[model samples]
Target: MNISYKWLKEYVDFELSPQEVCEALTSEGLEVGSLEEHQAIKGGLRGLVIGKVETCEAHPNSDHLHVCTVDLGQGELQQIVCGAPNVAAGQKVVVATVGCKLYDGDKEFVIKKSKLRGVESNGMICAEDEIGVGTDHSGIIVLPESAKVGMPAAEYYHVESDYLIEVDITPNRSDACSHYGVARDLYAWLVRHGMKTSLHRPGCEAFKVDNHDLDIAVEVEDNKKCPRYCAVTLKGCEVKESPAWLQERLQIIGLRPINNIVDITNYIMFAYGQPLHCFDADMIKGNKVIVKSLPDGTPFVTLDGVEHKLSHEDIVICNEEEPMCIAGVFGGKGSGTYENTTNVLFESAYFNPTSIRKSARRHGLNTDASFRFERGIDPNGQIYALKQAAILARELAGGTVSMEIK
Candidate 1:
């Protein structure tokens, strides 16, 4: 279990540095594996700014190069030859001046005052990956149009000091797999050390099933195989990119942010110790959902674009039309939520561990949801978890309360 220091701070207020927190957690029986600091390339790349693009004439000697006079905000213009097609006047960009060391890939390059096409060039502009935010480097980063001429880009970008701490949690400590659980442990540590602990529960209440529009009808075809099941339906949702705070929270935990709808489900699962799934209500072929054993040789495609064959013993989720998702394992491609989806049907149910494990092993699809269901989570928290997802969805995605099943 990887616990990001940034995410861990939300649950508890501790004065300890990230390294100190890791050491403290490790001393209290939780194994802190390693801490990784993601830093940007280019030393002395601190305060340079894109003052102005004085001249952007095509390089006389090179076809793809543009020689421009860039204002470094220190009252003097610097000449640099840039290859990016988007370089323009008044665009704020990073300037790695001469004598600066930069990390490209596995090696480092020292920037030196050089001549390009007979023009004395001083520095180079940077991309996202070149500055270590992400792997995207298709184009030069255009600073926010409002960025001041001489302001430090690092301060504006907040890339100064962030670290990721890897946590090794034992099987019995499944609760620690979540941010709340880790915070619980940290709270205990704070109390033990006579320090202040201020962890509070979310103000939003658990979702109630009786107050929605659409009714959720769940047919547990084999109760012996799937011991418990719960579902909720939400209407009028807007599926879009998650808020920066939510995306950063997930990114800190090593999860790539998909969208607000999906991020809410994942956030609820990590926060309340229950796994939840959200289906685009309109994408479901039928109004009803059936959870049952798969028939012999039923074929399905999961969300990851992988095809899987199901046997009789495997459990799956189906509508009147076809098997839409492999229950407790993975969602099928045909019935997934997309950018235009509005209504959503969220699922938070308990399955027999053996049943899920068998189906996962058969399909060779072991995922976070499967791993949690296989090891067993708090079954009674099904409805509670579902409600949490609904609240987040409604809050983040602008959805209406529709229906729920307790």
Candidate 2:
């Protein structure tokens, strides 16, 4: 399990350095494998600044390239040859001035005067991936109009450095599966050692259902397999990119941020150690979710686009007529959150560890949700986690919650 030092500090107050925290965790029976420094942007985006495109014209020798003059807040304009089709005049962007270093994996290269298609370029426009902040290579990053020209990109983007602590969790230590759980254990140790510190959890007190606008019903067929299942519906969500703060938190712990709806679920899962799933409410036929087993030989495709035949004992989440998810294991291909998912059905449940383990192994799938479910997560926290996810979805994705949490 990877834990971010900065993220952990939010859950528990501690004055220890990253190394000290690792040592304390190790002393408390959670073996730390490694502790490494992590930068939000590789090199902290040093020598990069915000620039505005002053003039952009098609390259004389290339069909897709554009030669552009950019204002770097300096007296002189710098000419750059950009290959991105979206390069345009009067747009703010990130610029790697000459002498700036960019990294591709571990290899680093310096930006300098160069020619592209016979056009002399003095600097380079940066894409998110080129600077190690994201994995987008589609086009040069376009900054907001409010971004000041010539401001340091790192400062403008609030680039941060953190420490990643990798802990080797034992089979019996399932409670230590999340950031909050890890902090709880650390707090226990602090208390044992006579330290005055308190473990804090993200408040769910503000999680009041706004209305019954999108009430999705849930039914659990086998109590033995699933003891508790909590679900809430959210509507009017704008499924765009997550806020920068949430993205940073996920990225700091090595998780790729999807959209707001999906990222919020992932954030709550890692935060509370409860695996949560969100379904596009429009796709839930009959507005119903039934947790039960499908017959043997039933073929279903997971989100990864792989087809699997259902076993008799494999638990599935169905929406009136079709299986929408392999319960606590993986999501179905067409039922999960998408770019147009305006209404969401959030799920937080506790499944029998043995049932989840068998299903995961039978399907040859080892997902984050399955890992925690098969290890037995806190059953009682399902409602709290569900509420927290609903609160976040409404906050980050602009949604209204249903009055009933089924």
Candidate 3:
């Protein structure tokens, strides 16, 4: 469980630095495994922008090089020999002036007045990865056309450093894997130490649910395998990339952004200690959802694009025709939601811990959901979690609740 400094600040008010917070957590019971500093590579590289491309001529010495004159926002023009093919006139780009530290591929170098290919080059143009935004170094970073000629790139990018505290949680402390769980512990500690503890959770009252012709039919063939199941169907969802803030939050937790619909489910799971799943309604074949033990010699493909063979003891989520997902394990790729999906069936349920453990071990796959279920989270809170996810999905993805499964 890696807790970021920015994330921890949202739950409690403390004047301690990240290192101090790690020490506090370690002294309390949650052991800190490691500490990582999140720093940008280009130190002191700011306020330099592209003025104008004076002349771009093919290099006389090298075949792939282009000798050009770039204005450094100041009146003087600096000649730079660059090998990037995308160099053009009137483009706003980063320029590493003298005395600035530049990092490229694990090697850090200080910019100085130097000559390249017999041309006096004062600085070098930068890419996105060079400035530490992303890992794309295929070409020079092309800024937005509206970017000012002499503006600080850091200010425009809103780059901030953070620290990641890797937490080693014991088996009994499975609840601490989520942000809300950690917040609970921190809240207890803060109240005990006379510190401020007031964290706002998203309200779920404005959401409305109606019973209509559309209804989710769930049949658990083996009650011993699945203890509880809760599901909701949402309509009018627009699946797309998540917002930057949401993406950053997930990245802080070491998860890459997928989409708004999927990220909301994942975010809710991390925030409230419940695992949720969103299924494509249009691809569900029939309106029925069945939770039961797999038949003998059944096969399915999970979300990770891997084929899995299911035994009779394994539990699965099936539609009228075939299995759509492995219950408490993974969703199948065939019935998954895509960019074009408009309707979705969200599931937040509790499975028998022993059954989930056996299925995970048999399939040789241990997912986050399986890990939590195997360790025993709150089993009776699936309905509340379903309502929470439904409200968030409606709020973020512009969806309507059609029906709910209980």
Candidate 4:
């Protein structure tokens, strides 16, 4: 498990350095294996700024390259030769100025004055991948007109850094799997050692139900296997990219950011140690969810596009028509949220650890959610995490929260 040193401080107010934090956690049984500082964007996007392309003309010597004059808000126009097929004038974009450093994984390269195809180039127009934010090399990232020219790209994008502490967790210590969980232990230790620190958490008092516009009924076939289940429906949500802060939080902990709907679920899971799933409500045939086991040799496709045969004891989460997820383990391919997904059915459930472990091993699969579920997470936190996710979805995805928690 990876814990962010800065994120951990958000909960426990300790005056410990990074090395001291590892020592403290090691003494508390959450042995820190390694500590490394992580930058959300390599080099923190220093020396990069927003620039407006003033003029774009084809390079005289190159067929594909274009020579452009860009306004960096520095009073003078910079002449740059860009190779992107989509480069055009009058567009606001990211500019890596001369002497700026960019990264391709661990490798680093510096931007300097150079000649490309006999045209003098001063800087570079950046693609999403070039800035370490995303993977889109087809074209440069275009900014909205509201973006301020000459603004530092780091400030514009709110780039930040944090320390990642990789901890080795034992199967019995399931409670320490999340950031809050680890903070709780640290808080207790601090109190015991006469430190005047307190534990703080992100408040969920803001969670409100706007209207019962959508309803999803849930039925559990076996209560013993699933002791608790909580769900909420969100309507009119725009599934798009998550905010920069959210993406940074997940990235520091080594999780790739998906869309907003899926990212919020992942954020909540790591924050609270509760695994949540989101399904495209439009794809659900009956607006109902049923938790039950399918027959032996039942074939199901997961999000990874792999088909797995199921045993009779495997618990499945199904809509009125068919199984949508391999309950607590992995989600189905078509039933999950997509780019056009507007309505979502978010679920939080507590499954039997032994059952989840058996099913996960049977299919030769181990997911983040299943890792937590198989080790026995807090059953009581399901509704709390569900409410937190709903609150985030409504705020970040522009959705209306459902009144009923099925």
Give per-model CA RMSD.
5.1, 6.2, 5.2, 6.1
Q: How well does each candidate superpose onto the true structure, as a TM-score?
A: 0.75, 0.77, 0.76, 0.76
Q: List the residue pairs that clash in candidate 1.
A: 212-402, 213-402
Model 3 TM:
0.76
Worst 10 residues of 4 by lDDT: 201-210
Better of 1 and 2 by TM-score: 2
Compared with the true structure, all predictions reach lDDT values of 0.77, 0.91, 0.77, 0.91
How many Å off is the CA of 204 in candidate 2? 1.6
Worst 10 residues of 3 by lDDT: 39-48
lDDT of 1 by residue, 1-406 (tens): 7676766777788888888888888887788999887443343345344455667888899998888887767888888898888887667777766665667666777777888868778887766676565577777787776777656666666555567878787777766767777888888888999997788656546444435677657788888777888887888878899997788777766789998988988888776668888888876666888988767888888888988888998888888778888888899996767898888898888888888888889889888888888777776878667777877777788777777464
Candidate topping lDDT: 4
Compose the digit string of candidate 4's lDDT tens values, residues 1-406: 9999888888899998888888888899889999998876779999999999999999999899999999999999999999999989999999999999999888999999999988899999999999987899999999999999999999999876679999898999999989999999888878988989999887779888888878878899988888888888999999999998799789889899999999999998888899999999889778888999999998999999999998899999988888889989999989899998999989999999999999999999999999999999997998889988998998899999965887
Residue-wise C-alpha lDDT for candidate 2, range 210-236, written one tens digit per residue? 888787788899999999988888889
Candidate 3 ranges beyond 4 A from true positions: 39-97, 103-109, 115-157, 210-214
RMSD of 2: 6.2
What is the lDDT, from 0 to 100, of the residue 266 in candidate 3?
83
Which model, 1 or 4, shows the larger lDDT? Answer: 4
Of candidates 4 and 1, the better by TM-score: 4
